[model samples]
Target: MTGNLTTIGFDADDTLWHNERFFRVTQDRFAELLQDHTPVELDRTALDHKLLAAEKRNLGRYGYGVKGFTLSMVETAIEVTDQQVPASVIQELIVAGQMMLSYPIELLPHAQKAVEQLAASHRVVLVTKGDLLDQERKLAQSGLGDLFDAVEIVSEKTPETYHEIFTRHGEGPERAMMVGNSMRSDVVPLITAGGWGTYVPHGLVWEVEYAEAPKDSPRYNAIEDLGQLPALITRIEDGL
Candidate 1:
C-alpha cells in the first residue's frame, strides 16, 4: 500500500524473472545423473527431498545462489552414491551450474510493465539475495536495470538487512514495502520489521525457502502475480 510506502522493494529471482525453472530443470538432470547409483526402486520424490535437505544444510556455508545449490547437488550425489560418485558426474554437475549461471534472463509475465508503472509513483528498488556476480549479471541482462531506483544484491533477507536497506535508501520500515515470492526471506521479515509484506507465490518454490504464510498478519497480503501489484499499490494510495 502507498499509504506510507515511499519505497517498494522487489525480489529478483522467481518473483521477477524465470529463475526457479532453471534450478528445477537442473535438479531433474541431477536426479538422472545419480539415478544409476541408487536402486531402481528408489523413489524419485525421496531423492529430490534428499537434495533439498543437502541444500538447506549448506545454505549457511555456501549461501544462496547457483554456486551454493550446485555444491549441494554435488554433495547429495556423493551422499546418495555413498562416496563412490564418479568424476564425470561431478563434472556434469559443475557444468549444470555453469549452464544455470549463463542461462538467459526471461522476465516474468508483466514484470516490466508492473515495475515501470510502480517506479512512476514510488522509489522501486531491487532487493534480491544471492551470489553477487550472478545476480548482477542477471540484472544487467534483464534490461530492466535502469527501471530501479537502486539495486541491492544481499547475502540474506533478514530484519536487519531490510532495516538497513530502508534506512539507507529512503525512510525506515514504516515507509517501505517488500514484494517477493519467499515467505521466509521476503515477506515475513519485512512485516516483522513494520513494513508491508506482499507475497507473490511462484509455481516452483525452493523447499528451503518455504515457510508458513503469515496470513493473519494485518500488514501482509498475498497476490497472484506481479500484474496485480500496480492496482494494489494504487488502492492503498487511494485509501480504498
Candidate 2:
C-alpha cells in the first residue's frame, strides 16, 4: 500500500528485468568445466551448493555481480577439485562472467507497466547494488532509465544506504517504500529502517540473498508479481 509513500525505490536486477537466470546458465557451464577435474562427475545440485558457498566466502573480498561471481566460480572449481583444477577451466570461468556482463536485458512480466504506473504518481528511484557499469548498461538497454527520478548503484543494501538515498533525494523514509525481489537486499533492511517494503517474488533466488520471510511485519507486503503493484498501491492509498 502506498500509505505515506511519496517515493518508491525499485531494485534493478530480478525485480525489473531477468538476472538470476543468466547466472544459472553460466553456473551450469562452470559445473561442466569442472567435471573432469573432479574424481567423479558432479551433478548440478552439488555443484550449485559448492558455488553458493564460494560466493558467500568471496562476498567480503569481491562484493557482488559478474566479477565477484566469476572469481567465485574459479574458487569453487579449485575447492571442489582439490586445488587441481586446470588453467583452461579458470579462463572459461572468466569468459562466462564476461559473457554475462554483455548479455541482453530481458524485462520481467509487467515490469515496464508497473514502473510507469508508479512513476506517474510517485517519485520513483532505481536503487540497485551491483557493478556500476553493468547496472548502467542494463538500465540503458532495458529502456527503463528515463522512468526513474533517480538511479543509485550502491555497493550494498543496508539501512544506512537507504537513509542516504532518501535523505539525499529529499524524501523521508516514512514517506518512502522499497519494491524488490530479495527479502534480504530490497525489503527487510528498509522495512526495519522505518520504511515500507513490498516484496515481488522471483522464480530463483541467489543463496546469499535468501532470508526468512518477515511476513508478520506491518511494514512488509508480499505480492505475486509486478502486474499487481498498481492495484495494491491503490488499495494502500485508500488505507484498505
Q: TM-scores of all models?
A: 0.95, 0.94
Best by lDDT: 1
Error of 1 at 84 (Å): 1.3
Ten residues in sequence with the least summed lDDT for candidate 2? 1-10
The global Cα lDDT (0 to 1) of model 2 is 0.88
Model 2's TM-score against the true structure: 0.94
Top candidate on TM-score is: 1
lDDT by residue for model 2 (68-186), tens:
99988988888888889889889988999999999989999999999999889898999998888899999999999999999999999999999889877647787788999999999
Worst 10 residues of 1 by lDDT: 231-240
lDDT of 1 at 216: 88
Question: What residue runs in model 1 are displaced by over 4 Å at the alpha carbon?
Answer: 1-3
The residue pairs that clash in candidate 1, if any, are none
**How far does residue 7 in candidate 2 sit from its true spot (Å)?**
0.2
What would you estimate as the lDDT of candidate 1?
Answer: 0.90
